[model samples]
Target: MKTDKTIRTHIVFSIAIVASALLEPCANASSIVGTKHDLSSYTNSSGQICIACHTPHNAQADQLVPLWNHAATTTQFTLYSSVTAKSVPGQPTGYSKACLSCHDGTLALDSFGGKTPAGAGKISGANNLGTDLSDDHPVSFTYDTNLATAHPGIVSPASAAFVDTAKTVPLFNGKLECSSCHDAHDNQNTFFLRKSNAGSALCLSCHNK
Candidate 1:
């Protein structure tokens, strides 16, 4: 007994509901906003949370990304290297340096936005990577066809199957970095990982074994 107009209205409403449901997760606030990274405890009356690592103007000029408010670390790192490792990791560059700005534990957490807060101090506990990176996973390394050939266990980044999916490990300018494994803005998975490591799926994304 319904008219064509009524049927169209119901269809439109259903589509709108489905669209909102799909976009909810993406619209949700990032975990880093109010988490320990907030650094408002040491900030001087600036209640803005994102200001800890980002700014609207006067960002770091040398940084690859825009709106970088934090001071980049200068500590020379002892990069991860092993006899079995094929890729040559030179140094932490790009987003890896942005993560190390606070995580390296050499600089004060509140040392951002061109103003160091009073009683500011370095990061502590497991979050502190320090100047030594020998114990951590190798970063800032090329992960291309040559490296994949040397280490047959790893899938080539250029492979269609490897690059087709959204969950795959990302490379920055054809080089793997900390952001390759971790999504700093998202914490849907543990350790801010790009994808859930359940059943070692995240690890298996690149490594065949």
Candidate 2:
């Protein structure tokens, strides 16, 4: 039989230990946890980390995507308007909003998660890519799948691309997602593109004609 004081002390200690363990993962998850974002290197600010873009959290409306912060862009983006473009924008669909959350330059990159550094750390810094998105090709809508419907499928059986044997990355009916052409990690192609469509091969991969 222990005194009430002894029991209370033990309980308090147990709670403290459990709390610390739970916080361990949260602390470790951040690449720029306590340390401020390096101004010289352009690393993300405090509380923002690699997990900010690639984790399990509130995420975006797309649901297919991983963790994301920053408000999804609502303004109609300016795209590369030309005859060569095979897609047309009707309202951004699928995870296209999530892709724009970063690429569109409307939202600050470190707005979500926890605290971020003030002043120079803001994404609006001259070097930080901002809302003028005209340079990148348009990405809100789906591509012309009818053109590639005739090709023999080349994707692997277990690959995500194989679910619809006839479907292709460039031909998805839904909105084009960042994942459509890029795999966030360990990409063999430059800019994390899913395949080597460099130069003309990239365009010809789907637009066979």
Candidate 3:
């Protein structure tokens, strides 16, 4: 059993490495500027472009987040609020700005600086991610006491508290990201989720429906 598990893990890592290399050229800063092509070609519908998340310089440990080139938007994002808001408000948590930096569609897609061929200019985007995030799912809030009270059956603060700790240790501790539910490299489901069709199935992965 142990050997099988190790082999599976190795296979997954190997596959990820190959996929990332194939998509690296597309991640070049130039493409994000104005080069218009099917962005979906690099990775499956999951939006798992290698350069999009990783970087050549100053990449995260083992290059999980990778050395991304674009500057993440430091501005405070408007988080979802309601009586059911189990987490704190307007703080950077969950996948937070790191994930939204691109999905929000406001910051320059290729804003992350990268080594480009000579004579090439910096990449910039005309599509601004508007302030209205109501259309998208909520992010950047603390999953503390309130969540325990409302959705005690589902969310727990234990994972949220480890965001900083997980970075140096296991690297991932059940935190949510676009990939938390969706697989950016493989478009297998309606929303690129890693499993069966989304909607309730995706929610059920984390929550009890």
Best by lDDT: 1
Using Cα atoms with residue i matched to residue i, what is each candidate's TM-score against the true structure? Answer: 0.79, 0.50, 0.50
Root-mean-square deviation per candidate = 11.8, 14.9, 14.6
> Worst lDDT window (10 residues) for model 1?
27-36
| Candidate 2 global lDDT | 0.49
Residue-pair clashes per prediction, in order, are 0, 1, 10
The better-scoring model by TM-score among 1 and 3 is: 1
Global Cα lDDT for candidate 1:
0.80
The predicted structure with the larger lDDT, 1 or 2, is 1
Between which residue pairs do clashes occur in model 2?
197-202
The regions of model 2 sitting more than 4 angstroms off are 1-50, 60-64, 83-86, 114-135, 144-173
Candidate lDDT (C-alpha), each: 0.80, 0.49, 0.48
Residue-by-residue lDDT tens digits, candidate 2, 1-209: 99999999999999999998666545534233322231213334453345555446666444434555434556575555555444465444445665555555565555444434343324444433345445655666544344224233423323444444323343344445556665544233444455667575544444334
C-alpha lDDT of residue 24 in model 3: 57
